[model samples]
Target: MSENIALAGADLRAAMRICMQGKFPGVQLYAHDGLTRDGKPTAVAARAACKEEADGRKLQGPERIAALTACFNGKRPDLAQRSECRKEARAKGLDGADLRKAVDACAREARG
Candidate 1:
């Protein structure tokens, strides 16, 4: 039973290696079965860029996490900034092509 379990583990690792290679293409597999080429357990590194703002205020706790998740899912947090640009243009009585040009300028300035 121990030998069968060991074989199954090896099979799983081999399958993982093949799948990783096919998907990643150029990424080198640094470890197999948790040990590195130097026979050390792979160290996992994690980072959180959870600083998100809404209406010029920083989000906290669950709100921050939710915003981070939204960012991870490809949602742009700068959408509010764009909306603000549109509002500013309208307040200045801009319309038609003039409003579009002003909004574009505001968007560019916001990005900078």
Candidate 2:
């Protein structure tokens, strides 16, 4: 049986908010799932900007991880590293709940 690792939804949301706030004041977030109208990630430039914001936050440990996951949720090809990081987390049996917590932490840190 495959072990289920949960990611923290709150953390993920927080991280995403932090990452997005830093870059965009009211930009909408979207999930790509490796598919788009052209079979590729859309809004590449916007996604790239968001990634830059996340990277600039300098989130460490789980917080960093959560930020990356949020980036993937947006399907930003510019954030190739984040996408890979998400894959690695899944491979290591990391859960979404845990990731969410990390994201939340990042958001709090960024806001403060």
Best by lDDT: 1
- When summed lDDT is taken over every stretch of 10 residues in candidate 1, the lowest stretch is 43-52
Q: For model 1, how does the per-residue alpha-carbon lDDT over 1-105 read when each residue is reduced to its tens digit?
A: 355444457688788789899999987688655546655444321113223233235777787677655653343335556778999999999999999999889
- Against the true structure, candidate 2 reaches a TM-score of 0.26
Predicted structure 1: lDDT? 0.65
Global lDDT for candidate 2?
0.61
TM-score of each candidate structure, all chains considered together? 0.34, 0.26
Instruction: Report residue 21 deviation for candidate 2 (angstroms).
Output: 40
lDDT of 2 at 1: 88
Candidate 2, residues 1-112, lDDT tens digits: the string is: 8997565786876777678877987654454342454555555544665578777997778887788667755665444544455565566677779765554554455446
